[model samples]
Target chain A: MSSALVYALTGAALFVLGMAGLILQPHLLRKILAFNIMGSGIFLMLVGVAQRAGTPDPVPQAMVLTGIVVAIAATALALALARQLLDMNGEMRLPEEKTGKDRLDV
Target chain B: MRTLLNVTVLFLASAFGLALGWLILDLPVAAVRLPEQVTAQLEMSGVVHPVTAVLLNFRGYDTLLEIAVLLLALLGILALPRHVSDHQHRPSSANPVLQTLTRVLAPLMLLVAGYVLWAGAHRPGGAFQAGAVLAGAGVLLHLAGLLPAWATPGRTLRAGLAVGLLVFIAVAVALMAQGTLLQYPLSWAGALILMIEASLTLSLGLILAGLYLVLTDSGVQK
Candidate 1:
């Protein structure tokens, strides 16, 4: 297999891992981290799949650069919201997910 | 029940992974050869680097919208209600070693950011990367207590935050008088792109750093 294909496969695995983490973990911070991981996986997949034919494609590379910037902005926004929640409620968790001992799972 | 839910989700996620991997493996060679096309139009696109050309010329609208999105994110953070206990206080100065390191390193980082911004025309650097570096320097200064967490930004700071998008939109609207939106004339493309990138670098730096600074002073952490 080509190196790009390997990267793509790893990205797939990472996406799944991130998805699992996003679902299973109750902490807002961990959820944010998982969301970032999922974004990275998507970025990797995009570039890897595009370059899988052995030629560097500037289009996908540029897109990935754009994606990175957007991801960071999204992350920052999420963190701000989480921080706001923490300030108001004294915890960084969704109201729905706060069920007993697992609420303090972090 | 939580364990059962977790197990089921894990199993489904694993299955999804397998499917995604299979789909990736099955992806046929792309019919369109974008690199060749990008190379062919490289001269007209104004920048020697293909990625920069695509980012600021061919796909300039995307970058324009991206700056808007970034600004919106900062605005969203600013819109959040301020905690009453959150005061305009500076973090205590860190260890002398860290402070000294920040003093030495911040200027160097700014220099690097400038170089990167200039180099995007022909190399693997650009406004986004440069802006990120600039923000990193700001974070470092804040961490070392050379800079304080932001309260409300002042007029000059606010103007700086908006300048990039303003310049970008002005350019786009000006170009629209001649033809379609963001379609730069071949003769003016390089200079226009550089101007835009410079403004973008400044604004992006502020916005990115604001994302951090606006949160730190919130007294959120336990």
Candidate 2:
């Protein structure tokens, strides 16, 4: 009924959509976009929760601000890795030779 | 099976939503009033409301940390090898109409960004939103070939990227020496917010522009 609840529900839906994109899309860039979408959703949810007391909670707001910066940093690192991978191989596809297990070992 | 999964998740989510809606349906609206601690602080400070106070003073440490993270990102991007083989050039075309449009839009966009930065103290507009707009303008310029794509980012770009973090950190250190981690002792809250917003806008714009360049140069077309 409240606007905060509406925002929370919207955020949850966005998070689910983003998660689905992350899982189904194999492209690294798409994955990054999906991850950013998910981050935005979480930020929205936190802000919504902060609105519960009829005033914004500075703690969650501040945390989300920090989260946004960290998300961008992680994204930049991922982009760099993706670029290196592309350079090594002409194809943009993830290497079929290395399984998830191999990546974990490294 | 996929349909079944979708239906199941939707049903469960709806059920939860219904339960939550019912639980809060009868609660007195006044019960949700903002906490006294926030209001008391606002009253005692004789300044703006809780949100502004909290952002600039109460939890300012978090903001400073966020700026540091942004700075780290710029540093990381700068550290990346800035050598792209000239053999891999993509033929870019220039259009006079588009160039003219961009030239006109750039100044207007910059003005809007400034307005957004100034209005952020008590509104929805802020550093992030304004910076995004400014970056959009930069992207347009880049597309129009007004800006060169150097493998090495220029000194001005680097300075713009670091200014927000440096300013924020300097202010935080000053505040720490005065006792509080980021408290604006003299109650120059408006001035402090403006300073942070301006620096943040510049830093964010540069970061976005840098990211755009990296993404475009990566040649990962969708």
Candidate 3:
């Protein structure tokens, strides 16, 4: 009903979307993008929920700022790892897992 | 089978989203009023801007560790095995217009970064924003072929990269002599925050720019 609630709901949807992409996307870069999207969703939820009373809250905003920096650092590290994989294997996707009965150890 | 998995995942995701949305809607009003507390202590926190005060003062520890994390990421990238690509080594031949534009814009960007860093004390700007601007300038310079991709960081560059964190730790340690970690005396809070922010701006700029620089093909070349 409120603007803050709207933002929070949108963030929840983004988190779900990102989670799905993280599971289904084979490309490491895409997975990283998904991870970032998930992080953004969390940040949005954090600030939005904290400000649900419509008052500006500095703590969550500051936390989100810190989160943004950390997210970028994590993303950079992930990208570097992915780039190394691409250099070595000539592709960015991980080897597909054997599914169904073949995936079962027994 | 794949279709079944997709259907299950889609169904689960939607369910999760609905639950989360419902939970948000149901959340009771928070008992703690952090904004009021921040406002009450804003003068003591050493900055006019509440977010800036919270970042560099109330929750300074997070920012301190954040800089370290950024430096560590750069280190990880640097430690990756070197792969010299001949094509990467070839000098970038940028468009003359872009080059000219970069030459004109880089100085202005530096000025803006400085302004943003100084403005953080009273406004929305802060070290992170300022450093990001600086990093943007570096990326632009590289794109224009005005700056070379970093190979192994030399001694000076390494020092510059570590200086912000070092300064922050030093300040924390210095403050510890008087009280607990990072507890600045009321008199020195403003100056101390500014001093720390100035160094952080430089180091954050270097570290953030290094994130992009070291990942480039030319940077990977030994």
Candidate 4:
């Protein structure tokens, strides 16, 4: 097994872990963390793919670098929204039940 | 119904994982042969490897743009409301021991960050990594209450945020006037890379500081 393959497998494991966390965690902050973990996994996979070609592909590395910056920007915005939501609700926890009345209120 | 949804999501995820796994497994075997076109280009360029040339010169545009994105993020953060008062602000939980430790470690962190920036010319260490380290020092100070959140971002801070983008954009435009975008005139690659790396280090550090301040919602003063 090559080192690239190891990197890919590691990335896949991280992605699965992040996906599970996203599904199971109710807190917005934890969900954000899971999303970031998933993103890191994807970026790692991209880097692994880039390494597959004989010569290094600056293209994929560059794209992944761009993606990292964009991901952080989006995460920052999402965090700001989460902060606002917490300010209104007094709790960071997401409500589990959504009744008809809740839908109407929203 | 919820269980069904969960199972479906899992199945799809597994399929995706398997595809990636296959790609990884095939990569080594496929990589053993070089494409004719790539070999031809290598011969023409007289440069054994083109990746380095492309990264530092040919596609330098991408790198410059990446730095710009970071600069824009800093600007956006600065434009945001300084404090969101409604959110509960956590008080400092600094202990004397931690404060003493951070005071000693701060200088060491700064030294390491400088080393990383200098090492970026031909190695793995680069502006982003160095800036993150430097910002870690600032975070430590903030946690120690040595620096307050609202302490004026200081002139140095503002300059740091803008330097990367300004230098990159200026250089790129100058190159464009010479008939190609981001092309460095002969033998200047090292100098250009160093300048870009230095500015990027400052910009990245400022961005990290801004992010910490935004997340903590603390006034800038210590």
lDDT of 1 by residue, B78-151 (tens): 88876556464556675799999999999999999999999999999999999999999998888888887767
The DockQ figures for the candidates are: 0.79, 0.25, 0.56, 0.30
lDDT of the structure predicted as candidate 3 = 0.88
Give me the candidate number with maximum DockQ: 1
Candidate 4 Cα outliers beyond 4 Å, as residue runs: A16-26, A52-70, A89-106, B26-56, B78-94, B150-156, B220-222
Q: CA shift at B17, candidate 4, in angstroms? A: 2.1
Angstrom error of the Cα, residue A105, model 3: value is 27
- TM-score of every candidate: 0.95, 0.75, 0.94, 0.78
Clashing pairs in 1: none
After superposing candidate 2 on the true structure, give the runs of residues whose Cα lies further than 4 Å from its correct spot: A20-25, A52-66, A90-106, B1-36, B43-52, B83-93, B218-222
* Native-referenced DockQ of model 3: 0.56
Candidate that scores best on lDDT: 1
TM-score of chain A, all candidates: 0.94, 0.83, 0.88, 0.85
How much does each candidate deviate at the interface, measured as C-alpha RMSD after superposition?
1.3, 6.0, 2.7, 4.9
- lDDT by residue (tens digit), candidate 2, B1-222: 445655676666556545544544443445434445666676433235455556556666766777677667656765766535546554243778878898999999999999987776666667777888998898888788676554556688778888988888888777677776776755576687678779988988877776766556633232
- Candidate 1 lDDT, tens digit per residue, A1-106? 8999999999999999999999989899999999999989998999899899898899999999988999999998998788778888998889998774573375
Worst 10 residues of 4 chain A by lDDT: A97-106
Chain A TM-score of model 3 comes to 0.88
Q: Give the deviation of candidate 4 from the true structure as CA RMSD.
A: 5.1
Candidate 2 chain B lowest-lDDT run of ten: B24-33
